[model samples]
Target: MKKMEDNTLVFIVDVKVNKHQIKQAVKKLYDIGVTKVNNLIRTDGEQKGYVQLTMMLWMLPMKLGSSKLSPIG
Candidate 1:
């Protein structure tokens, strides 16, 4: 994991890594639950199958939209 501006972080992961794997790894390693995940696949001449994973972890759920804060909205 690389440090980004402010407190954000960036990670370069393999394309084979699934969403569940990412969630487990982030939770196990950082003890934080990711609020959202953005995945972009980049397949060029170099790599057969490559993807960029972007995970946004919420420090506090209160900052999110009111609707998102509720379990059933």
Candidate 2:
């Protein structure tokens, strides 16, 4: 639960999903290259995946009723 200085994204994934699946999914969905994958099972019975990306994404949250994301300039 600590702050990550690296370009890491935390995702709550299914228990059956493996590291390879997570890596591929991230690439396909977000177009971000993953450098590494770390998995941890939380006490609440959920799997948290720490995805370290190859590049930093300067993207902010979508606006109200927006269909796409906008990167900060």
Candidate 3:
């Protein structure tokens, strides 16, 4: 994970996940507003998604340490 700016967060997710799907998932799961989603393909064949949230202060007190896959709209 990377912190690009005050309001942006970077995540490495499954390549099959799309930008819109990511935006929805982040919004629903975190209860935070997402302004945008950008994708970056790495040389080693990994997908990086940089999410622009409305505010970084809305992050939960606990860290998102696990990559659990659940049903997300």
Candidate 4:
């Protein structure tokens, strides 16, 4: 996950899973408190017959504050 200058959280995920599983995972994140979840892009995986997904999310300050430091620095 990455934090933008305006405080929006960005997540680029690549998962070798099906669409249903991806929806379930995103829903679970929302259920657990992730806000403004968005599916940025979805594409087939490099490997044959697999899938990949990309998501962008905006996180609450309280949530970001409690998390570990970002690795970007």
Q: Using TM-score, give the best candidate's number.
A: 2
Q: Per-residue lDDT for 1-73 in model 4, tens only?
A: 3444433434455545444554466456644323334444445533221112233233432444654545352
Better of 2 and 3 by TM-score: 2
Q: What are the per-residue Cα lDDT tens digits for candidate 1 across 19-72?
A: 567656756665554554444455642212121224332332433433353222
Q: Give, for candidate 4, the lowest lDDT window spanning 10 residues.
A: 47-56
Each candidate's lDDT (Cα)? 0.43, 0.72, 0.72, 0.41
TM-score of each: 0.44, 0.72, 0.70, 0.30
Which pairs clash inside model 3?
Answer: none
Residue-wise lDDT of candidate 2 within 1-70, one digit each (tens)? 2224666778889988999999999888776679999999889889988888777544312212344644
Deviation from truth (RMSD, Å), model 4:
7.5
lDDT computed for candidate 1:
0.43
Candidate 4 residue-wise lDDT at 6: 35
- Candidate 2: where are CA atoms >4 Å away? 1-4, 59-73
Q: In candidate 1, which residue pairs clash?
A: none
Worst 10 residues of 2 by lDDT: 57-66
Which residue runs of candidate 4 sit more than 4 Å off their true CA positions? 15-32, 42-68, 71-73
